[model samples]
Each structure stands twice: as structure tokens, then as C-alpha cells.
Target: MPRIGVTGHVRLAEGTAELVYAELVATLTAHGDGALHGVTCLADGADQLFARAVAALGGTYEVILPATDYRTVVGDRKTFDDLLGKAVHVDYAPFATSEPAAYFAASELLLRRVDHLVAVWDGQPSDVVSSTANVVRTARDHGLPVTVIWPAGARRA
Candidate 1:
């Protein structure tokens, strides 16, 4: 069982989610060989897509909240709550609000718990401290294997 983790953009273009999810399933199945496990922050786009794919594959996943008020800032309330309920375990960062520092803290914690990282980025750098690219960089710095998934038709909104 591979403990894979995910980090990526939140605003995906229309119909991009399906493409990313398919790629995720393929990657996860190839890596886990059936028994799959994932770690995610459960944000709107990439994180939610990864969780759904994991469930579709009959895998388990854990959720990491960037802050106590993360849910308040997330885009899709219903989807976020549903995914949160399905998580095998949930962890929270020390911060009380959803900010860059809290997100960075959560990402660091998420990195420590997984053996591999999957980044669904568009290969762009961001000014935000805890951007997907930064997380990918951090994972690489720690010598963790990362698989970047950007399908042909995938685009960020």
C-alpha cells in the first residue's frame, strides 16, 4: 500500500477535473497495484479530485486541514464536508485561520506522512508561500519522489 499525497491548484478549468482524476487513478493504480492510500488537504480542485479517485479505487485517505477555519474558506461546502466525513483520519494545523503559513504548515505535515507526492500543477510558480509549486519543491528538497500530473486537456481557470 502506497501512501501517496496530493497538492495542486484549486481553480481548475471546466471539464479539467475529469482529466486530472483519470490520470490520478492510473498513476495511483500503477503505484499502489490495487491497495491505495492518499493524503490531501481536501481543497476544491486537485485535492477533492484525488480523494474521489481514491474512493473510486476502493482506497483510503487522510485529510489535513490547513487551519481550524479551513472549511469556511473552501469553495464547495457540500463536497468538502462529504470528503471530510469520508477521510479515515483528519489532522489540523496549529493556526486558527486559513493563511499561507497555516497552509505551509499543513503541507509540511502532509509531506512527512506520505512516501510519495502527486502534484497536479500547471508548472507555474506562485507568490503564495504554500503554492503547489512550492510544495513540489519542498517534496523534492526532502528527496521524496514526485509525479507531476498535467493532462493534455487540463487547464486552470
Candidate 2:
């Protein structure tokens, strides 16, 4: 069974959550190559989506908090939510950093631990490296294969 890593925007519009969940579940299901043991993440966007899918698949879910201060970053609500009961571990990040730095560290750590990365990118091209293409690049640099999905109507720049 492979461990899947998920990363995406936390500010998706209404109704996008369910769609994202469905697409991720479908992708993991379609792989059909092995059972997925669990998912690791910070409990937002595609991370939360993957965790829900993992539980639905009768698998475990793990969370690697990007900071020791979960209340400040992702919120206590995200960690304490009823859906996360299946988590085996919600490891705090080893290094200390702020938001963006924490993301860089967490993303790298998540990439190292998981067998595959399912990037739920917005598919937009920006002046910054926040596009789906950037996600593909980072995953490749870390040597993790990436599977990307964007909702049908979300503009890709």
C-alpha cells in the first residue's frame, strides 16, 4: 500500500470541496495498483480531502502539522474535527518557521514520506510559482511522482 501526499489551496470556493474529494477518491481508486495505507498532511484543501478518501477506503490517515502551533496556522478546528479520528499521527514540524517557510518545509517532508503526491492545484499561471505547473516541478525535484487535478471551471490563467 502506498502513502499519498496531498497539497492544495485552502481557499477553494463553495462546492469545490465535495468535487475535490470525489476526484481524489477516483484518482486513488483508479490507481488500483495497491492498497493506500494512509495520507499525511496539515488538514486543509487536498490534504483533508485525501484523509477523507483514505478513511473511506478503510485506510489510516496521518497528519504532519506544519507547525507545533496548530492553533495559529491551520486552526484547532481543523485538527479537532470529528473526521480526523482515524489519524495515527499528527507530527509537529521539526524546524521552526512562519507560514510560507513552514509550507516549504512541510511540503518537502510530505514529499519524502509519501509514495505519491496528488497535487490539487488551481491550474492558474501567476507571477509567482503558485501554479499547477509549479507543483509538478516541486514534486519532480523531490523525486515524487505527481498526479494533478483541477475542477473543470476553475481558470488556469
The sequence of per-residue lDDT tens digits that candidate 2 reaches over residues 27-97 is 88876564676656545666777788877877676877667665455544745565556688767667564
Q: Per-candidate TM vs. native?
A: 0.97, 0.81
**Predicted candidate 1 versus true structure: per-residue lDDT over 5-114, tens digit per residue:** 99999999999998999998898888877899999999889999999999999999999999999999998899999999999999998999999899989999999999
Best by TM-score: 1
Estimate every model's Cα lDDT from 0 to 1: 0.94, 0.68
What's the alpha carbon RMSD for model 1?
0.8
How many residue pairs clash per model? Answer: 0, 0
Q: What is the C-alpha RMSD of each candidate to the true structure, in Å?
A: 0.8, 3.1
Show model 1 residue runs off by greater than 4 Å.
none
Error of 1 at 95 (Å): 0.7
